[model samples]
Target: MKAILFEAPGSDPIFTDVELAKPQSSEVEVTITAAGVCHSDLHVVSGDWDIATPVVLGHEGSGIVSALGPGVTDLSIGDHVVLSWVPSCGTCRYCLAGRPAQCSLVASVVAPLGVLHDGTSRLSKDGRTLHHYLGVSSFAERVVVPVSGAIRVRMDAPLDVLALVGCAVATGVGAVTKTANVQPGSTVAVIGCGGVGLSCVQGARLAGVSRIIAVDIMPEKLELALRLGATDAIDSSSTDAVAALTEMVPEGLDYVFDAIGKISTTEQAIAALGLGGSAVIVGLPPTGQHARFDPLALAEADQRILGSNYGSVVPQRDIPWLVDLYLSGDLDLDSLVSARRPLSEAPAALVDLAAGHALRHLLVPSI
Candidate 1:
C-alpha cells in the first residue's frame, strides 16, 4: 500500500509504498475512501508534539470495509464506516463510566507505544516497523483499525464529508453539546474559525444559541463562519478579540470556545465568559504550554474552565446523529470541504494546511 511516512519531526513526510499486515482477530481492514488533512496531523508533522517517528500520519477518515478479522461480527465487507482515532476498550474504567473519550487503555498504552492494543505495528517498509498515529493512520490507501474504532454509517453519507466527522466535527459539536452543554438563547463565542471552529459555530446554531460570535484573524474564515451559522464575526488580527467580545457581551458570554489551541486564545475565551459562564478549551496546544487565569475572578464569578478532548464524543452515538443533521441540510458538511485532491497531493495539502490556506482538504485515495 502507499502511505505517507513521517520519518522525523520538523521535516516533510515521505510518500512511499509500505507493507500492511493483515488484521488481527479483533481488527478490521478498510480501503480508504477519503481522509481529511487535519491540523492535528500538521501539529505532529511540525513537531509540536513529540510523536514517534517512522509513523503513518493521519486519523480523520472514512472508508469501506475490505475485510474483517476473526471475532469481528458486527461489521463485514462493504460496510461504510468512519474511523475514530481514540478507540476504547469497553471494559476500561473510563469506558464503563460513559467517558470512553478518556479510555485509560488508549491513553496509557496505545498512544505512547504508537501501536495497536496488542502493542504491535501493522505497517512496515524495508523491514522497518512503522508506528500508527492514534491507531488510525488513514493517510494511506488502506488501514487496519480495531473494530471498536470503526463506526458504521450509511453509505449515502458522502465519504469526504464523513471524513471530517471522525475528528473536527465530532470535536467541535461534541464540545458544545456534550462538554459545555450550551443552553438555547445563550450567547456563545468561538475563537479560531478553522475546521473545528466553524463546526463549533454550526453546533451553537443547532443548539439554538441566540448569538453566535465568530472570532478569527482570518477574514475569509470569519466570513465562512457567518455562512455556517455565526450571527457576528470579528477580525481578531486587526481588532482586539477580547475587547470586541467584551464590548459585544458586556455581561460576558454564556459559553466561549477556544479552538485555536493557543494560550492567548484560551485566555481570550476565559476573559470573555460571563458570570457563571464556561470556557471550553477545544484546541490541543503544544505540550508544556500553559494559560494563566485569574483565580479570584473565577471564584467570585463562578466561572468554569473545561478541557474537551475529541469533543467528549461517543462515536457510535454522535456520528449517526451528525449524519442525520447533514442529510436534513442543517449541518453544512459540503462547505467545510475546501478542496479535494488525490493521495499523491497529500504532502502539498499538508503544507497548505500549515500555511492556513485551506479548510478540510480531503484526500481521495481512490482518485
Candidate 2:
C-alpha cells in the first residue's frame, strides 16, 4: 500500500510503497477512505514538535473496517469508523472519570514511542520499520489501529467529511461543549480561523451563544466564520485583535478560546475575558512552549485558564454525536473540507495548510 513517511524535521515527506502487517490482538485493520491534513502533523514535519522518525504522518481520518483481530467483538468487517489519535484504556482512572482524552497508557507509552498499545508498529518499507503517528497513521491507504482508537459511526454519514470529526471538529467543538461548557447567551471570541478555529465558531453557535466574535488574520476565514455562526469578525492582520475585541465588548467577553495555541493568542484570550469568564486553550502548541500571564489579575477577576486536550472528548461517545450533527444538517462540516487530493499529494497539501490557503484538506487514498 501507498503511504507518506516523514523521516525527519525539515525534510520533504516521502510518498512510497510500504508493507502493512496484519491486525494483532484487540486491533483492527482499516482501509482509509479519507485522511485530514492537519497542523498537528505539520508541527512534527516542521520540527515544532518532536516525534519518532520514519513515521506515517496523518492522525485524523475515516475508514472502513476490513479486518478485526482476535478478542474484538464491538466492531465487525465493513463497519464505518472514524479514527482517534488518543485511544484510551477504559479501565484507567481517567477513563473511569469520563476523561478518556487523558488516557495514561497513551500518554506514557503509545505517544512517546509512536506505536500502538502493544508498543510495536505495523508499517515498514523495504524491511525498515516505520513508526505510526499518534497510533493511527491514517496517511496510508490502510492502518492497523487498536479497537479503542476507531469509533464506529453511522453508515449514512459520508466517510470523507467525517474525517474532520476525528481531530479539528472534535477538538474545536468539544472544547466549547465539553471543556468550557459555555452557556447559552454568553459572549465568546475564538482567536484564529483555521479548521479548528472555525469549528470553534460552529460549536459556539450550536451552544446558542449570543455574541460570537471570530478573530483571524485571513479575510476568507473571517468570512467563512460569519457564514458558520459568528456574529462578528475581526481581521488581525490590519487591526489589533485584542483592541477590536475590547471595542466590540467593552466589559470583556464571557468566554474566550485561543484556538491558535500561540503565546500571543493565549495572552490575548486571557486579556479579553470578562470578570468570571474562562480562557479555554484549545489548540496544541509545540512541546515546551509556555505562555506568561498575570496571576494577580486572574485572582482578582475570578477568571480561569483551562487546557483542553482533544477537547476532553471520549471518542466513542463524541465522534458519533458529531457525525449525527452533520447528518442532521445542524453542523456545517462540508464547509470545513475545502479541498480533497490524492494521498500522494499530501506534501503539497501540507504546504497549503501551513500557508493558510485552506480550511481543511482531505487526502483521499483512492484519489
lDDT (tens digit, per residue) of candidate 2 on 277-361: 8999988888998899999999999999999999888899999999999988889999998899999999999999999888899
Residues 1-367 of candidate 1: C-alpha lDDT, one tens digit per residue: 9988889876788778999999998999999999999999988987889887789989999999999888999998999999999988888989999999999989987777789888898999999999999999999999998898999998887777899999999999999999988899999999999999999999999999999999998889989999999999999889999899988899999999999989999999999989999999999999899899999999999999999999998988898889889998989988999999998888899999988868899999878
TM-score of each: 0.99, 0.99
Model 1: lowest-lDDT 10 consecutive positions: 6-15
Error of 1 at 21 (Å): 0.5
